[model samples]
Target: MEKHSTLAQPDTLASAHRTFATEIAALQALDARLDDSFEQAVAMMLACQGRVVVTGIGKSGHIAKKIAATLASTGTPAFFMHGAEAIHGDLGMLTRQDIVLALSYSGAAHELLTVLSVVRRLGARLIALTGHAQSELARNADLHLDAHVAQEACPLNLAPTASTTAALVLGDALAVACLEARGFSREDFARSHPGGALGRRLLTRVRDVMRQGEALPIVHLDTPVADALVEMSTKGMGMTIVIDDNKQPAGIFTDGDLRRLIARHGDIRPLTVATGMTPGPKTIAPDALAVEAATVMDAGRLNQMLVVDDTGLLLGALHMHDLLAAKVI
Candidate 1:
């Protein structure tokens, strides 16, 4: 095969370092520029009776969409409307009760300006994120957030690198501030993100994953140790629960206990499960979060836990493997 010489590569690592430095400086400047306008913006969004509509174009539009998603997931109702699409017909998504968050690095994008005009006509509020304070969009907005940057990370100083980073961080700040103001809890966040790992950890209860009904390995206290071992093997839980007449867990016998019992005494054939079981094993409420169950099991170095009700009646059992299967671990 004919070979062609490759072009010499530039100092890519140095370029990346320079980009990081530039963006960090831009963020510091944006942080220092934060003032009453930011406070008012948060208050306005919190007071909004309708959704927050974020709109922008080009690179700014991507940032706007992310901001809208973050706000919606963090206890605020928000959505993105493309600037050009809004001018054509998507503006109907907005209502007088809604607040428009418009982004344009130059503060002079024509499509954003058109959306701004319609926003005013509809009696909706407008918040502008732009690099220029004196620009038309900034001047006309009900609130303006300055996302100015000294220079782009691009060596030519023309691309939207530093400016976009500043805008994105500013948007995150707004979302988090609103989230805190609304007192959004972990459960609330889990509700919005039901398909995510955090949702499984926060929203799933012990009852949702614990083994119950025929899957439980139950043996009476008077049962033979060999019988308890059979129940444990049949249930595949590595342990058997010793239950009383009231179906309350009296004790638990694990494989470890069986091993220790054998080591302590050579004659095991005459013993009942009571001689080898661990009494008053750790238990948790069925309604407790699965992650909480995991914490308790981890703290005690236990593999199995009994789920009970207020009256201490055994409802089910939870193996560490169950949490792993449910992805709550």
Candidate 2:
């Protein structure tokens, strides 16, 4: 285990405040320094027919990896190529159609310089993110993004603190600009991040989560209220879908409807499902997103919704519980 200093609370807080202030100032400076160069970089990325290969060494390498992931998830094809690894066998991954995004605070990492030389020889475009525009890496690049910082957030000003943050933010700006330029949508982003929560919500369809076939609670308008209740119980959806003679959804009978029916008529055995069913209930298409179903249910203050086809034929049923179980809520 590492030993920690028994520092006072106020001193620790003061140190944190100073670090935040310094980093904020650095970001403000970067924001003010944005120019047409940033737009040109975005244009290069948008026009590239191949992937964006981000390369860096040390702390910048970590930032580069994150930037690559952000770009990839946001509809841009990108991957990280470590600077040191590029000088080895990884340079083979680059193609003349691809663009190289190099990060180096000092703009003089030996590994990055070697990769830069290979990138130039292959006729690939280069975008350098560095603190010094006069450095070799920035000077040789087709476009240089000035990620200059007045000082590091570190108290000693020795670590790559503010500089790395600026580079990461600049890379993100480029990725977002490219994404908007390409008209990337939420569906596109979900396709790239299928394992994430947003992907589950955006990609999952009503058919994917709604109870269907035997699991669906369905009945006719003439079905007895008692039998409809049995179907609801068996399906565990707290509701039963009422269909017409043509097999189209007519309405829905839910637990709340049953309660209201009981309140209105003491002798419930005489009532048919049609008497208690809510006609013209809000419905969603089977191919619509599960999140859309959730939105409809929420807006109507309903606990259940019926899924139908384009012709209004009953396809399935969705309960709020189904949305919760599918983690789409």
Candidate 3:
């Protein structure tokens, strides 16, 4: 049988909570430590003529990679390089126009020192995220951000728990601040992340996926319910848009309406679309996002909607299946 620690489950839970509390306090310290230097760092990055190169080792390296990705997606162009690899031939990637962001919990990472020297020689400005403001990396940096924490969340204070969290949050702060400074919009982010769901939401317009031209099931308001049903059946969209003499949307008729009409009178053939159809049906513009169409369908308990122009002229129609096929669902 395996032996267990004397700590009970409640004690373990308490320890976990204390760990979270300690890290939260460390982040609070970092928040209070934000100063003019952070502004200067942002300015330096904004003025860079080329890409930002972020480098770190170990846990800091993981944080650096995420920071680089966030910066790239948000607006600023950046890439991550291992500090040790940077000292190798990767140093050739640096140029006079680039800026270096070096992350180190201890201000004296030996691997980073070699890279920092080359960066200085290359005329690239260096920004240091270090715990000690007076350490060698901080002293050499053109902009030094103090990422110091009072203690590690680790019980023994040996592992880099609280310290790494502070660094990661500080990096996120910088990325978001730069994003706002650049006036980057969702469209810009979508362009960067074209393969993701958010990209689909921002990049897809209603007209791109809506059934238009001959595919739209449209009929005159005076048309018989039988004729409307034929149009709906031919289009296979479960609905037909009823238009007035001016060629503008007057109303709509759907499969549900047909079933309800049968339930009420058992005779839909005698009715005209103008008398049996729903008046003033909900419609959407072609330039709107497909997600907005999904929202309307979900809210109104509808299966499809008519796409109209500003003057209420029918331009297209979209079914729930269309949205599902487009992955907008």
Candidate 4:
């Protein structure tokens, strides 16, 4: 039992090391072989006015699905097709305007090749990522990328190993190139993934979430300290705007101001709203993004701020608590 336990862990570690080494060597070979064909593949994808169809067999098929997803999420439309299914009715998914990306470590996966005739008939541009340029898939493809590796990490040198890693990296290269070509932006990505927290953080606008109009806790610049305190308490936002007769924001009265004035004067009534008000308060536009408002608040070192219209008229108020409760932070 002792010998068996000792042998098992070391065997697993050795197999892992061999696998990593083989995959690294395969990526190195693929890196060395990058040439104009890669450029042509990107150009073919860029020219496609339709989706990109990714296909493979076995482990390659799993990798192909991931590649397809990445492409779709990053501004390029893409879908995965099982190579064997293409021989069935799935070939109908392909259109002349689309581009086909084929994957095969040996460059001769039979299931993948079964659709070569249909690919030509569909007139879809073909780009092959393979380990052998002379293989049937490469020979038939309109563009070919070399995915060669010196050896497999397997004891028998038969596992997919390095070849699959090389294929995946090459696929990533294609996706990123197309992503940049299309000028994909964070906003675009957010639209593709609106359900995630990141999407809300980036895409949610201030107008969508900010308090507005009469909901704002506001006091006129002429308001007495007692009345201003009433505004703050009733609004429950911890602060209130003090506006001039023209309805433009003249100052802001906060809980901090009330505390300081009481400590100094010992009488809240004798201090008018203007006396306790801060002359210049940080402000935001109602149309700004919620994340941007959070950034502005943090940068100014304040917990609460006033929201205004583009022409400087007071529109609403926001507190750091609003952001925290909305999970914008």
lDDT of 2 by residue, 248-292 (tens): 888889898999999999789988999999999888899999999
Per-candidate TM-score against the hidden true structure: 0.89, 0.85, 0.82, 0.87
Q: Is candidate 1 or candidate 2 better by lDDT?
A: 1
2 or 4: which has the higher lDDT?
A: 2
Candidate 1 — which residues are off by over 4 angstroms? 1-9, 263-270
Better of 2 and 3 by TM-score: 2
Candidate topping lDDT:
1
Look at candidate 4 and tell me the lDDT of residue 176: 94
lDDT of 4 by residue, 1-329 (tens): 45544553457777788788778877777778788888888888878899899998888888888899998999888999998887788988888998888888777898878777788887777888788889999999988888887887766878776777777898898899988998999988989988777888888877777888778888898789998888889988888888898989898888898899888889777668898889888888887999999999899888888888889987788888888878778
Clash tally for model 3? 0
Candidates ranked, most accurate by lDDT first: 1, 2, 3, 4
- Residue-level lDDT tens digits of model 1 in 1-329: 99987988889999899999999999998888799999999999999999999999999999999999999999999999999899999998889999999999999999999998999999999999999999999999999999999999999999999999999999999999999999999989999999899999999999999999999999998999888888999999999999877778999999999999999987788999999899999999999999999999999999999999999988999999999999998
Clashes of each: 0, 0, 0, 0
Locate the minimum summed-lDDT window of 10 residues in model 3: 7-16
For all predictions, the C-alpha RMSD in Å is 2.6, 3.6, 3.5, 2.8
Evaluated against the true structure, the overall lDDT of model 1 is 0.95
**Predicted structure with the largest TM-score when compared to the true one:** 1
